[model samples]
Target: MPALRTIPSKAGADPLPSPPREVEPRPATGHLAKAVRRNLTAHGFLIGAVLCFAVFSWYPMIREFLLAFQKTESGRSTWVGFDNFRTVANDPAFWQAWGNTVLYTAFALVLGFAVPFVTALVINEFRHAQGYLRLLVYLPVMLPPVASVLLFKYLYDPGYGLLNELFDLVGLPAQQWLQDPDISLLAVVIASTWMNMGGATLIYLAALQSIPGELYEAAELDGAGLLRKIWHVTVPQTRLVLSLMLLMQVIATMQVFVEPFLLTGGAGPEGSTTTVVYLIYQYAFSFNNYGAAAALGLMLLVLLAGFSAAYVKLSRTEDE
Candidate 1:
């Protein structure tokens, strides 16, 4: 018993070691097969859309060029070269339409462009009721364009319109809004702005929100008031969006048809509201001159392309 007590003993035995896990390498062919399947699935999903575009968009665009240069007589088609274009250019209505289009675009820039920007700025600065205000601003756009135009047409009636009534109540003379040639285009622009401003306003509001609050804070420290802060902090911050919206507004105004069309029978008093697109419509439907219509379309397409190119060049130059 004395000898056993003198021996040292271990407190615990060591645990057995666990076996290592075996890992299998993935086959290279498996990855390639997965990618192939993914691509095939994607293409399968896209086939319908691709077919639709080819049939509806691309094919018609190709046909427009063909129709622009071809004439049909006695159930036969023949090449007309530039004759269709010449006819379009020679028509007195063509130049008048161009003039009207340009004038409308100018007015649209003033009302459609500026009003929405201002509205967005005002709405964005609100600490409360922003959603309600924006919704109100955008409410007219929710109406169908035709409905909006017709509604404005009624509202612009000289004898019994609400606008005239309001003017009378305010001690201003009731004016012929859409009947007078001088103000018809202006009236159409106003109605178009009322109907269309919502989208642009929302876009501008979104752009305004993305601006850093620090910029306004910095401007304030520099004694900038509302106008100064807007000029220095807001416009500069949102210049890119402003430029884009400006271009979009120009294009949209250039194509204005429904408002002027519905409001003034596609041409205001003395053809004041007749735009290029309306002219094209007249050529195709009103007059049944398909070749001339296509030619006008081609001319419009060229002008828009030139304008877009010049705009891009000028904008880039200014940015540089």
Candidate 2:
């Protein structure tokens, strides 16, 4: 009773022995440790890649944009805002170049897209000499650009060109190929198509091979004719590849420079063959107007971006 008199009440006293202390979580080891290490390594690699991309790709793009807004005087750059853009917009040649570029793109796409797909389809359907045909089609793609363009230049020569010679033999009027400003671009397109179609043909051939043979066999058994089978089976099968190739061709055609440069000697007669890219070259290198060149480059970027967005939308719609 005496000891109890000094003792705290049950409610006030520690109702139970002190709760056991929680054990601190030990550092991970073995597999857990290995997993953590692997994660950190992967994160480090990703960070390094991001840094490289920022330094090499993003930084240059930003620099180019900034340069477009700057004017240079005797190696000193001064901020000029939209002045360059205004100048470019006011230039008549810009519109001409843009029109020419659009025309070239259209011609290239129609010729390039159709010819390659047809060639690929024909090659894929062949039972023999397929290898030789494939090789022959692809041979042009392997030639150096300079050599190919030069070869075309000779073929397109106005007076003694093979084309004119053939026209003479056939008693038809010998129209100027590269000499006439009106038809020079079309002539160049033909040459470019010949050289460029080889790669596209090979790509389409590969895509065609990937289609299931059963689809064709089934179509054949159902009394589907060749054209019907292609429309019902082949086209549907290679639609994605065809769409992707079309997009690529549009982009490539938009940036065309070498063919016009080499074949027509940089824009050709009366600037009829001058493309947007060639105009940019004239601004930057020919005239040394860096600001204007930058503006033109930005314009090209915008145009290409629009084209790319449209292509993506069309592709998505197709997928849906």
Candidate 3:
């Protein structure tokens, strides 16, 4: 029989030291470094857009404001705060131009805003031939503004114009269109509406198409008439889009220039069609008063910005 001997270490002796474990260090990057690199990548992607906005949008706006407060003489610029604004305000054409611009905006709101909406409604109700009708409405927008304005000028002539001829054919007395100061703005509005309404019509069509049929059905179930249904259901549904379009139309009409310029030589008979933008052109190009032009432009900019701000706030509140 063989017996195995048992071995034991001393109780107080230290155990054999273990081997050192392997540890891999991180890439020497911390959370802050990671965030910095991520932000750099994002900013690199946005640099092009930032530069474009700075150069075209913000820079021009700053320059406009600066020009409003400055005057250049003999190739030297002098700071003249409020002087340019006073000159613009004091000019006899200044008030007339503002009045005409306001009047033009009013006419545009009536025709430009309502015509496209009504057109969209009529076209949307047609299941067939919608495309054709829409095409006809949009065709005017394809024409160049210069050509359109010139054609309209000929049509609005007091003598031997197509419109006057049509009036004669219908056994109606011929009337002066652009020649009369009273209705010159109205005539211009009509031409502008014809030229510009296609885009608004298309936008309205898209908004109308987005509405649900169920809303109309519900309104009908409630014994609502056509007008009632439209008022209660359709208008409520499209209010947001309508408000947005109204704002855009206001901005466009306020900036009108080419039509009045080409149609009536920048100012209609008796200075009837002298819109603010047209007046600005006269100040800058015709009169060579850049300071006054900048001042007048700043005034318009402030007015429109205020109007838009108020409209947007009201719309947002209603939505909420």
Q: Could you list the CA RMSD of all candidates, in the order they appear?
A: 4.9, 9.1, 5.4
Winner on TM-score (1 vs 3):
1
List per-prediction Cα lDDT, in the order shown.
Answer: 0.90, 0.90, 0.90
TM-score for all models, in order of appearance: 0.87, 0.83, 0.86
lDDT of 3 by residue, 17-130 (tens): 899999987665786688878799787869988999999999999999999999977777789999999999999998999899888999999999999999999899999998
Tens digits of lDDT, candidate 1, 171-232? 99998998899999999999988999999999999999999899899889999999999888
> Positional deviation of 315 in candidate 3, in angstroms?
2.2
Q: Residue 14 in model 3: shift from native, Å? A: 30
- How many Å off is the CA of 311 in candidate 2? 2.4
- Candidate 1's C-alpha runs over 4 A off are 1-33
* Superposition-based RMSD of candidate 1 using all C-alpha atoms, in angstroms: 4.9
Highest TM-score model number: 1
Candidate 2 C-alpha lDDT tens digits along 197-221: 9989999999999999999999999
- Model 2 steric clash pairs: none
Q: Cα deviation of 231 in candidate 1 (Å)?
A: 0.7
Q: Regarding TM-score, does 2 or 3 come out ahead?
A: 3
